[model samples]
Target: MAESSSTVGKRKCSQDRQVDEKPVPKKGRSLCSTGYGIAFTMHMCNFIVTAQCTVINITMVAMVNSTDHRFQFNDSTEGLSGDSSGGLNNARDTLPAGVPVYNWSPQIQGIIFSSLSYGFIPMLFLSGYLAGRVGTKRVVGVSLFATSLFTIFTPLVTELGLVFFIATRIAQSIVQGSVLGGQHALWEKWGPPHERSRLCSISLSGTILGTFAIILLDGMICQTLEWPFAFYILGGIGCVYCPLWFVLIYDDPISHPWISITEREYIISSLADQIHVSPCKQPLPIKAMLRSLPLWSVCVCGFTHQWLSITQIIYTPTYINSVFNINMRDNGFLSALPFLVAGVTGILGGQLADFLLTKNFRLVTVRKAATFLGNFPSSVLLVVLPYITPSYVTTMTFLILSCGLSSLCQSGIYINVLDIAPRHSSFLMGATRGFAFTAAILAPTVCGFLLNQDPELGWRNVFLLLFAINLSGLITYLIFGEAVIQDWAKERKLTRL
Candidate 1:
């Protein structure tokens, strides 16, 4: 009887142990089996914010080309018989019906376009700091909402006079500037190591899509409805997107209520090698980051990149209209084509970059290759643009290729911050973007002065400036940029217990 009882107890103990040791498969279902929810929402957020950044491109073009404004000729010119002047005179005579131009001069227009950067530059650090402390979801959500509200009020602000209008735009710039840095912070928690490049690329591609959409729609809206409707429509879309962003996004997978156990586990495991710190409790390694040479290289490249990009965005329509004598409707379509090409190539470039990285190519080599391919070809094409005769189709083709090829940089310097310092990427991004906006402040003003001097000669000078700046960025980045994280970042000393 005693032996029988002992045997039964031992058997039960063995069964219990088996039950305890058995693995329980994660029961929670991912929002998407492949984790597309976070990716999709990030992409959407980028699209909305970038649209705000670029809507002015099309709106400004429409306003400048409107029929309500009077066209002035250079009083000092010897003859109005030059082919360029004659072409412009004929184009002005054929202005489309219902186009209403604001009588703002080129300089005023440049100020209006560049005003956003004034507000944009100062807020970069603040936004990143806030995102690090409070969490990106709240910071980004509020920023977008405020930006949209201001955008909706743009027409009223414009009616309030030039001073008030510029003030309002500056306010808008300050608000929207937060989005970029905030998103970078969020990616630290959200982007997986292997998929980081693709994710960042997809999100950034929103800028291209936004630019394309605004250009395609702005012209038609200005012609069919009124210029103010362009503001209303874009602002309304942003407003609608805000609620969705708040509902769908969480700062980290661990905190996301709706995330699956499986996906959460996957994210945590993938990011295990990266140092994680609660931003609220820890200080950023400001001294170390500032001392890092690679970071400064990124900033320098960003400065040059922004100078070229802002010039292209703000002036492309003007260039097309002034040089080729195209109408606003045609300008809209042609301007959008380059961004369309860019949008597609940006995705492809990102995918290819990730694939190469996975193949064990040297990180520095890949980055330089991508940057060279994107910047050098685009610069060559831009230099050729001034030499090309004024065939609308040919000019459009060159512009499209130049812009499209530039998308390859998306795979290079654009996401390099995330590579070198995943934990501090948001702050680094802010630093880099601050430099970019500073360049933005200068580029348009310079272009304005140049274009105002002589449209033909000034444009040639502008293209030449672009070529020089683009090449400089490529050279600097190749010489100084690094993909590996610095030892200071790896120390993880900034985190508090």
Candidate 2:
């Protein structure tokens, strides 16, 4: 089965009669309305328009309430009341002896939460297979509704047992995965080729922005309210966002109603060959994928990069606090700055990649240089971080700069995905992530061990070991990470035989 349902090439107009084109390609004269066209574009656009408006409204509400911390994330009267009953307000009795003085529960929970986070990768891959069977729109709609229900009910569960906590996290993880998988398939069909990168950047940037918002605002909120309210606020945002997705999003470009003929033609011409549409052919099998050496190369390189990212996400806060002797409040604020920098840099990197493409740079060269090479420098900087120990500000600035540079590689990794398997980019992306997230799962655990080694050399060794791994991955890509799918496949078959 082909991933997409419609083709971009010239199709017969739907109407029996033809007329000259107008500025916006008047709806009356649309090919969709003509007898030859499928009306896919018209239907899709109308849905997306509705969904976008809905999301805008939800954002306003979420952000508005977020600004008021009292309703968001602090300790509640109930929590305080319970604290008095449990500990009777004693200093040492309130929290467990080993735990940090400040609210350490949520920090510990964040680590546990991250473990569930990688479940989305497998869930996404599984969802992609299902989407190929059912219509993408149907799967997305059902998944979104399921996600919303789970999100809404999360606040209702007051009991904080390990089972309940893990269950909620797992459910949310699966939903997040489905959302990405469905959205990826939808974009492969609806997004114009020329606009794919920009549109994708815009859409996924939400995660980055959301992280920033949570870090910046959550601090303020948690200061005044209960930790449970933090989860409630985040869940409510998801609930609001889910409904808007249904209204605004369409599965394919041809299904959209609002796009002009000229725009449709442009989209078709740009992406027609890339988005496959064969209902007769069998879907690519897992065995066939395993035999593809190029795919394996992608998996390895992607895992390498992702492991580094996961390490940073999990341990960077610990790094800042231990290395700089920073307070929790300042750590939250400073931690956000790196992500904010990364988000900005990532968008710029995408633009730079496109610009380089215009200059006739091979996609492989551009991706390799921009992303893989960028990682090398970051690794080098990280290795040197522990060695420098004069001022806190100087050390932190370097760490931030290192992470900011590493982010440039993110766009490059996905861009290479398109280079290798344009027709099955989403499936390949799922495959890459499925393999990569295993490393993500281990990154934190390994970091914990390394950091816990000897007090003096522990953190230093952690940075050194991680840097070496990063450098080795970069070298592997330099030597063997072929970007051209056909060439890579050919070379692999020869080696195997």
Reference-based TM-score of each model: 0.86, 0.73
The best candidate by lDDT is 1
Off by more than 4 A, model 1: 1-35, 65-100, 277-282, 492-497
**lDDT per residue as tens, model 2, 369-481:** 87675588777777887777636687668767776777777556644565565556666666676666666556656665554445456667767877777777677666665
Full-model lDDT, candidate 1: 0.72
lDDT of 2: 0.52
**Candidate 1 displacement at residue 313 in angstroms:** 1.3
Taking all chains together, the TM-score of candidate 1 against the true structure is: 0.86
Candidate 2 positional error at 343, Å = 0.4
Q: What is the lDDT of residue 137 in candidate 1?
A: 89
Per-residue lDDT of candidate 1, residues 301-349 (tens digit): 7777777777777777777766655555777888888888988888788
